[model samples]
Target: MSLLVEMRGIEKRFPGVHALRSVRFDLKPGEVHALMGENGAGKSTLMKILSGNYQRDGGEIFFEGKPVAPDSPRAATDLGIGIIHQELSLMNDLTAAQNVFIGREPRKSFGRLDEPALNRQTADIFSSMNLKLDPKAQVDTLTIAKQQMVEIAKALSYKSRVLIMDEPTAALNDAEIAELFVIIRKLRSEGVGIIYISHKMDEIKRIADRVTVMRDGEYVDTVDAESTPLSRIISMMVGREVSEKPLDVPDTRGNEVALEVRNLKRGREIRDVSFTVRRGEILGFAGLMGAGRTEVARAVFGADPRDDGEILVHGKPVSIHSPSDAVRSGIGYLSEDRKRFGLATGMNVRANIALASLDRFTSKAGVLDERGMRETANNYIDQLGIRTPSDTQEVRLLSGGNQQKVVVAKWLLRDCDILFFDEPTRGIDVGAKSEIYKLLEELAAQGRAIIVISSELPEVMRLSHRIAVMCEGRLTGILPGGAETTQEQIMELATQRESAMAPVGEVA
Candidate 1:
């Protein structure tokens, strides 16, 4: 049978970035091909070329054994290629149905939008996918997970022969992901070619028939998904055999308390939470969903109104009534939802990096130092290993992992004394994750107090010098972090009640 899609020696270049070089990929008629790579690996760039969003500098593309060049996104769509991008690209003010059918929305006799037909068609698509979402719901009102599903539905609406999904499951929960897998299986049965891009190894094992790994800007190898060991694939993507090692925590017992929370209260969401994070430490916040780990972060950062609490920085009480105040007090927060809170997606990398410390880049006369800002951004881009053509690239153009790095750079540039990283590595690849881990440790070594909230116990165990577990909006326990601190201990603490708090550790 002829290959559904094939690319040979795919070469692409930006102004200062050689994104893809001799990259090769092929999709079968009815198989899930998983594309695995770290940030800046050119996975998205290659796919974008396929989807006709960008013109390939050099490559040979064969669709059904016929050589053809797709010049634009519409051209690719006409050829039955649909892509759900890594980032959400929906019109906020439009209805779910409107966003799904966007430019090609159904029209009536008078050239009016056929709202009823649109809603009905969208509803049918959602129903077929077992997605119980209202088609009339506003795009801005929907949750991130739901918005992601809409993106999926929009792609599926194209009835494409080839479907490319980039991190489709990044924003989805376990149940939503399972539903998506079912949909994938159905499409595979229908002889549709599926190109799945994600950093999640487990998903590759579960849904992919073949796995292709990319590193830097080159193709490594493609192998049977079930047969190959994940470690081998990871090694190919990272150019090293990554191993799981226990965290080595230095003794921070004598360090001065950098931030202290005394009886932090925010109604029932946060109940008298008391904890102290010291300078030169990585304090891990571990808890299950709805356990108030993020709530504490929000309350402390002044994003959420706290009914009562005493916040102390460097052993002195500080008044923090807003996020601006928190920043003024030398605190930086990296939210879990980077798209909504951490970044201005439409802005350039240099502008976003200089967002937090604008004063540092401006003269007293209010003149913006463009050259100085550019230099500072470039320095951090190199230092943080942020993948971009240049500092002038729009943040929305970068991969999810790269965007997360930009958010970190913003805070790092601000030179905050206390940092809050909420779910820092969610949706990021293993290679980028390792870099973020290293950056956190480096910040701690520089005497910056860090609070890292992560649901992954292994990650918590790996990065923390001390672990604080939360349960039902309260601090349940604080354990010493190391190889000796097991996931079982953290799990127990995560489910414990406030009334049953252990006396082994002093929280304040």
Candidate 2:
């Protein structure tokens, strides 16, 4: 394979922050390079410079043996370089075709939007990629997995020779991830150089040819993916030998029941969902996509309406019609899409942390308690190990892991006893994931009941005291979450659905 891109001595900086320190990376034609690092390890910064999202403070970039400087995203695209961000950038209201060809839409002679032409073009791209999607369908109506495919189609439409993908499978299930792997292999076979960044070690070993590790804003080492051990790679990234710590399943049966749902029915998405979570316990919800794990969590949290159900906090039935009601009943929900539902990206960390409990910080004269808010925010930042310059820093400026921590802080500040964490470590780095797991364990030990919903079987098995499996909107089974629980057992329960039950409404 020929050299496609060579970035040497790349350097980047922000006000009072040295983001990247003389990092180096190289890519070859028909190769997938996995970038491994902790959350502030400069992997994203390096990719941003390459994609022209940010200019490099210092570096030499060579493409096809020629020096080139891409000052804008358009310039990068024109130069056959494209990036698919961790967060999907599609417009919710627009059709897939419209979003794929947004800035350069075809126009009729009279200056009208050439809708048919755009749709046909998008259709062709999808067809070539073996992606089954309607070009005219609205993006918001599509599933997260489908939307991810559309993002790949849009990036490929740019005729990209080099592609950068960040945490592409964070939201995908096992089957969806397999499909994406097929697409990635197809792209690689076509001689497209790919820079793949993900925290999943199995994925890196399966998809990447070369592995690069970065630590503390500096390059650590690079090795062949097939040769280096996953443990060694993780150690290089975190500068410490990191191993999976067994979850301590404490005796919580004697503890009081924190939250209990009985016969939770929400128009088929949640059917007869009944469960009990005790204080000082971690309950894991495991299932495939459309299996209704998230729906159950949402119904319990009062983010969505429940058709027929009874909720009990501390063995006392309570009415919960909205999120505020759930909060008042000592419940908090950290949504899977944190940027959309969990945090206000435009606001500062302190403000977002105190958002849910603003009433407690308000004075009798309607005055805001700035000092109290800051103190609480700083306390959680220190406690949770959230990486931020200050409490006043914008939430959007933090990395994915830090953003998740901020959400955790918000719910903790609100003093919720029963917390629903949907995909808690999604899009977070491996090191940061370990930290989050430790924090969750600490929370459980502190007598806060936690229900974690995740698509990753290993994660569910590692974190829960008891595992609850859902299949097709029904509670298939529950198993002990320790050594006895295997992935095969979870898969069996995940696909076990009752044929007698009527089909429920569709979920996007």
Q: Best-fitting candidate, measured by lDDT?
A: 2
Candidate 2 lDDT by residue in tens digits, 1-508 = 5589999999999998899999999999999999989888989989999999999999899998899899999999999998999889999999999999888899999989999999999999999888989999999999888899999889999999999999999888778899999999999999999999999989988999999999989999999999999889989988998788777778888999999899999887888888899999999999888999999988887788989989999999999999999999989999999999999999999999999999989999999999999999999999999888899999988988899989989999888999999999988878888888998999999999999999889999999999988998998888887887899988888887696433422111
Each model's lDDT? 0.89, 0.90
Task: Give lDDT tens digits, candidate 1, residues 429-452.
Answer: 898788788888888998999999
| TM-score (all chains, Cα) for each model | 0.88, 0.95
RMSD of each: 3.3, 3.5
Best by TM-score: 2
Q: Give stretches of model 1 more than 4 Å off.
A: 107-115, 267-269, 337-354, 368-409, 492-508
